[model samples]
Target: MDFMPIFCDLKEKLCLVVGGGQIASHKAELLSRAQARLTIVAPTFNHRLLELGKNANVSLVQEAFSEHWLTGCWLVIAATDDPVINQSIYHCATQRQIFCNVVDDPLQTSFITPALIDHSPIIIALSTGGNAPTLSGLLRQEIESHLSTASLDPLSTLATLAGSLRQRVKNYFPAVHIKHQFWLKFFTDKMLINAVEHHDTLAINVHIQRLLTESGAVSLNENRSN
Candidate 1:
């Protein structure tokens, strides 16, 4: 992969958007969803952005872009139509060691935003290293459709349960390979699968406890034999 995939924690972090157009607005909205504090600079903003500015987390500045705006920003997006302004923003951000994305111009961007499927606690991201965004977006849509119709528990709910069970599993199976084997069996267990498909929390818990008990007994017997 040309670019490494990673998720950023932008909660309460300062982010700068240097434009007032739809693309800029979209980027700002994504940041706001991550709870980032935003400072948007543009001489004139479209209606959508103006509405977004009403949010307490967003601060809109009606002015031209300036290097001074980069101060304390964890990330910056250059969405202005003017190539000169975008280049300037990129250079300034580079100088300050800040991550910068110049809209659709990947050549000028230090980072590229991927198309995301946010199923909270189970987010999925797709990217083409900024080479083929349309293809990436199409694939994301198809995967999202499949996920919605799949005969499985909600991904977020499943992930949450797995997270809650992690410590218990670790405690039960101290060896890495044993823990891995236990999870593999647990997920594929017919009883657990049926419980998950029906969203039966009580059944799921009981199934887990029964499996743990059986596995623990087997481990103890193996140790006695050894």
Candidate 2:
């Protein structure tokens, strides 16, 4: 039951999805969003899937999946409703040691797809170990509301500020405890909330300035202690 958790970089990587139904299409859409170069294999495609292929950056192989189809793919998803077809895909992927997720069939999968909420640089994934996908999905939706658009802006601005501060005050390393404490407060402070809530660039900028001043103080104290 032990499994390794890792995120795959699918951008420009070969990915295969063996189905054209709604579940198959859903998996394909997620892969496409990750910039994966996808090839979908199915005897037929739904109307929406066909339209999506026409404009989307993907390939369509219209035929039943053969054992050879698993060749050269970085990851594969067996989302077809047919258990027989899914079993074939699982065995093929297992033989090749390629990661594969078979929807609703945990025992046959090498990986599990979690419910994800993506806000560009910020991604939250929820997993129920393939027990209740619907519940996980609902939980993800609930968690999404708490992460406001503004919550991310301060973090982005903080990154830029941190880079400049690092260069401005070079050749000094604060004590690990002090450094950790300073950043913990900086990131989790009310200033971030205010910056996000008001959407005021000025407020966010001020928050960054305060954080820089605090870091400077900590650095000066550390030097004095030494």
Candidate 3:
């Protein structure tokens, strides 16, 4: 089967994990970091899981999984070592039309969570479609070495500022074509990339204006040449 790519926003959304073992604990940690309202259901939880749940403010349900436990969740994860239990959780989630993932059981899952690198405001996700998780993890490590803490803050700030500029452009122009050209010009400009890579906020701001001005100049030159 061909691999599919999906990106999700889980902020403040209710997410369920039907296990308390190491696998479930790992998933719970990622969900919590994504700001998902996480709920873990199992008869017992590991101490590490318990401590993380307490610290990261996740709800732990020390009970068996039931249909009632699957109510109103945006997404569900089945991470138990017990295949039968995981299958049950997957079935329940599917019956309710909610998104479900069965860890290490790709065929039974509606979605697969990728190996993630979270640099605040910048997120990188790597996946191998369940074919090779270890390989995926190794690739993630390689990617981490190339990314630094210094790059994210500036990149995110520039992205936000770019959005603000696009919004202002839309308010004035109100044309999809013009808005698209603005984005194309914004992204293709070398100065924007240079400024962001070097974490130069002032240079980024200056380059943004220069790019816009240069785009306008080119447009006018084309009109006159015609």
**Candidate topping TM-score:** 1
Q: Superpose all Cα atoms of candidate 2 onto the true structure and report the RMSD in Å to 1 decimal.
A: 3.5
Cα lDDT over the full model 2: 0.80
For model 1, the run of ten residues with the poorest summed lDDT: 149-158
Query: What is the overall TM-score of model 2 with all chains considered together?
Result: 0.80
For model 1, how does the per-residue alpha-carbon lDDT over 1-226 read when each residue is reduced to its tens digit?
7788989999999999999999999999999999999999999999989999999999999999989999999999999999999999999999999999998888889999999988777788999999999999999999878887353344456678779999998998777766777777776788887788788989988998988887787777767888
Question: What tens-digit string does per-residue lDDT give for candidate 2 at 1-226?
Answer: 4456567788899889999999998899899889998989999998757866875678888999987888899999998889999989999998999999999998889899889987654567888888889999999989877877666666665555556556433433346665666667766778765675577878877876676678778788778888
Tell me each candidate's TM-score.
0.87, 0.80, 0.80
In order, candidate lDDTs are: 0.88, 0.80, 0.82
Which candidate tops lDDT?
A: 1
